[model samples]
Target: MPEIKKYLSIVALGENRDKLARDLVGAIARRGCEVNECRITPLGDHFSAAMLLAGNWSAMGKMESALPGLAEHLGLAIQFQHARPAEPQTDFRPYAAEVVAPQQPRLLGELLDFFTEQETNVVEVSSQAYDSGLTGAAMCTLHMALQVPVNHHPQTLRDAFMDVCDDLHADGLLDPIKT
Candidate 1:
């Protein structure tokens, strides 16, 4: 059986997240580690990357040492930490959702609260706020991957989320992720 080492997730942001990602991945590979997954997103003037990596425990120190130089050279901060392994809960259903609305304080907090109240487990979340250039309206958008217990019917969660969206005057959707 292969050793199950702890996973390390890195989130880096800077003027050039792509370069940072490439450099970081190269550095990790050089240290004999493998990157499992990486995703990059443009956050207005900045770029961000979320990466999942795993390898021999002994290589962690070498990788950590390389991080500072890359972070400094890239002119941004690179943060990493051990990630919790996924739960093998067959009773949980996967879901993908999004919420879009005019930018406002407390919108994100309220949505998170609803998720907590519903006993949903958030796997991944990314959000951005920007101006609708045509309308000049400030808009915020949230995308999330979730695991909802099978006991909670999809429609039930949708209805509850819709209620929150309605109250917040936002548009949202909750749909099962196709496995």
Candidate 2:
């Protein structure tokens, strides 16, 4: 039997600065942990990141023990939890959903609710609001990575999704993710 590798899920927030990413990744490398997946971005004046670290039991423990000191030294707010590898989902197909529209309250919530009603699994979501350069109108854009069940007909789902977008006064697209 293969040994089960340990995993750690970490989220950190700190004031944006140079060398922060290098320092954080270096710390993980020094402790012998490998970053399996990560998303780092600047949000306003702060830098935020979420990472999944993988390693053997000893390496995981070492990294976990060092987190508090690292957080203090870097002036970051850090949180971590034990995690397990995601099980393969052969019955699901990857898809991407994109929406762009005039900014409106509850727009994101309504879109999320629609997906929830269909029992679709939303794996990742990113959204931003800005003023359109042409019209100087407030606008919002949302992109989501989804694991859609194969049992749902793609055409049917796309049609339904389009209807929801029309009702929300948003332009949207739902399509398969190209590798």
Candidate 3:
């Protein structure tokens, strides 16, 4: 019989350092775990990372045991939990959404609410805030990967999205993700 694989989901936060990613990945490797997926970003003065690790049961145990001491040594705050890989969704199609507008309170919240109301699953999201060089106005841009239900008509969804953007005074686009 094939050995069942185990998984760990970890999120770590710390002051930004040049060696943090190397140290974290090395620690996982030393414990015989493989990083399946990870996102590490420098946010302001801090560093943030989220990773999915895969291993056998024993290796998973080793990682769980070693993580705390490693976190302390690195001055990082860490949290981890057992996790399973996401199952494939056949009834949904992958799409990308982008929105750019003057930064305002509740802008992100309102966009998220639209997705929730449409029953679209947000797979990943990233946003940035900056000042427009030409206008000297605060601006924000957001990008999201979504799993949209197949039942919704694509043109209808795009139209509705545009309407929402008009109401928010934003420029937005929704298109199928190209592989």
- Judging by lDDT against the true structure, name the best candidate: 3
Worst 10 residues of 2 by lDDT: 1-10
How far off is residue 44 in model 2, in Å? 1.4
Listing every candidate in turn, what is its Cα RMSD in Å to the true structure after a full C-alpha superposition?
2.6, 1.3, 0.9
**Could you give me the TM-score of model 2 versus the true structure?**
0.96
Candidate 3 stretches greater than 4 Å from native: none
lDDT of 2 by residue, 6-89 (tens): 999999999999999889999999999999999999999998989999998999999999999999998899999999878988
Per-residue error for 134 in candidate 2, Å, reads 0.8
Q: What lDDT does each candidate get? A: 0.83, 0.94, 0.95
Clashing pairs in 3: none
Residue 52, candidate 3: C-alpha displacement in angstroms: 0.8
lDDT of 3 by residue, 3-55 (tens): 89999999999999888899999999999999999999988899999999999
Order of the predicted models by TM-score, top scorer first: 3, 2, 1
lDDT of 1 by residue, 14-110 (tens): 8854465577667779876678778877778787778877776777667767778867876867899877655587988999889999999999889
Off by over 4 Å in 1: 1-6, 15-18, 69-76, 82-84
Native-vs-model 3 lDDT? Answer: 0.95
